[model samples]
Target: ASAKARLIDVFDLSDVQATYILDMPLRRLTKFSRIELEKESGELTTTIEELTAILDDDGNLRQVVSDELAAVGQQHATPRRTLLLEANASPAKSAVPLEVDDAPCIVLMSSTGLLARSADTEFDASADIARAAHDVIVSSVPATARGEIGLVTSAGRVLRLSVLDLPALPSVIGIPALSAGAPIGAFVDLPANEQALCLTTLDETGCIALATARGTVKRVVADTPGSKDSWEVIRLEDGDRVVGAVRLDDAAARTAELVLVTSDGQLLRFPATAVRPQGRAAGGMAGINLASGASVIAFGAFTPTDDAMLITIAGTTAALPGIDTGSMKVTPFAEYPAKGRATGGVRCHRFRSGEDLLTLAWVGNGPVRACSSSGVPVPLPTELGKRDATGVPVAAPVSHVAGSL
Candidate 1:
């Protein structure tokens, strides 16, 4: 008890700590207690000395902090795998800021009145041999993506169109269907009685020959001057409407001939020299002589060549259009000799029983294509026929025939 009291006073120990020390087994205390105490004292002395030296020197303390921070940063930073770039001035590259490049493109129209434009670069023709639905382009006009074109209507009105506003077709194989385009009716504000006939350029370099249902032919003189977007190209008489129109190279028209086919199996061909250029407001002169109840069904002016072809479709007047599957004949334009202006040239097609009028007719340079009124493509006969021979029966009615430009 006296020893415990002395130890407690010297160590400043509590009663429980003093009792725990005094109660230790004597042999264990003498052996392990000295070794353990000496080792612990040595470690504490080294740690205290090192800490006191670092605290005394400010530079040592800062160095330690910096080493720690650098280690942490090295461990957390991300690495780069690619190089970066910025625009420069060494090589001058002009800025092409156009929303749509002013590239050359072709505007195409389908028989169903749809219109679309496709890029002319790498314009492919390999897929044209294979026939498909909506593959027929009834009319195509060349224009730039940023230029303007003119659309000819059956009512003799020519309306200007912005090329940029047209729907663009993807780079495609074969003739594009123009299914992506809006209906022509949506683009042009036309009367219900009128319809768009074909496409033409608004430029003044060439002339456009037009034929009316009332047997009139007129050449829309080049150089249409006006800021007006739309104007009358021909002064159509009452109940008269344009049946066909085609662009003509003025130099070529000197040798070209105007062909007029009537509904009653009459065809007229005369040198385009027979007609004179007329102002936009001038009424046309007589183009073909038609029997009573017969009207001009088709007309075009073409320079006579071996490639020129005449296509005719025969049907009855009583049958609703495209309902009666008509007969078709493909004949060389040379089969019938040319006649004088305003004279019925010759009988182009002899009608079979129940067929009274020529439902469709075309005379121009071909590779021509045909389609039903509903836009389904119809194949033509491989055999050429005599000028006055009957046409071979077609599986379905052909409503339109168009030649490639």
Candidate 2:
């Protein structure tokens, strides 16, 4: 009673509270709980001592922090994977060169509607390479790595494209494969039913000779205005479109002949001098006298000294295009004599049993490269047949053929 009175006096507690605290029963713990309780009590006592020492002096707090950091380093330290190096901080232009050196390259167009450039300028088309996708290069033009080239489209329009923006082909032996090239639509804003035909230079020294499906021929005067990126090279009729285009010079045209092959197996050959150069707005003159319902399929100029061979592939007119491989004939161009303009051409290929029209044709220097519609490499006849002979059935379907520059 006296001790309770002293506790109440020290804490200023009521007598009833002091009596309740004195009568409260203690909690009983199990064997496991007693050990846990003792552990918790020891941890709390140690924490309290450490905190009291930190409050007593600043050195104890620093020592605790240092011990914690050292524990963290021992627990989670790892070997370095990257090293820090010093570099000079300078202007961006000097730090990184943004200019491409002017090097000779070839701009190539695959038959599968792809465009790219390659640094393999000394490759020959006659040499064999691995048969990969887009193995056939239909058109190739010489250009610098940073120069510009022209893309001639079927709509008789030439679109200017920067060579630097073109995709570069990896260096390889023999002819380089252009499977990584971009599609023509990626760079040119082409319209529906119109596609790029070939490549040419945007210079003024040479002329652009082209032929239309309606037997029209014209040599466009290279009068490209300043800074003009696109221009119409020929004026077509209601249903006419350009089939082929080639760069020409006055010296080459004098000895060269413009050859046109119609779908009905008619081929007309005439000196390039017959068709004169005309302005862009002027409609072309008739270059061949076609039979009713016949249209020109191939038109190109070849020099007399060139080992030019006429390539014609005939397919069943009843079947869907590219569905059949058909037959191919390679006739030497020297066998065909020159004819006058506006005259019906001589028979170039005799039709087979089921063939009625030509599905593909080309007249240029051989040996040419052929590929299927799916960009697979195709083989051609190793023999040079007669001028008016029938072609043999090809081993595979050939959708396009190209001559090496």
Per-residue lDDT tens digits for candidate 2, residues 85-183, read 237645444565668789999899889888888888877656666666676777888889999999988999989999999888777777766667787
Worst 10 residues of 2 by lDDT: 78-87
Give one clash count per candidate, in the order shown.
0, 0
Candidate lDDT (C-alpha), each: 0.82, 0.84
Give the TM-score (vs. native) of candidate 1. Answer: 0.72
Judged by lDDT against the true structure, how good is candidate 2?
Answer: 0.84
The count of residue-pair clashes in candidate 2 stands at 0
TM-score of each: 0.72, 0.73
Candidate 2's displacement at residue 223, Å, is 1.5
Clashing pairs in 2: none
Q: Which stretches of candidate 1 lie over 4 Å from their true place?
A: 1-98, 121-128
TM-score winner: 2
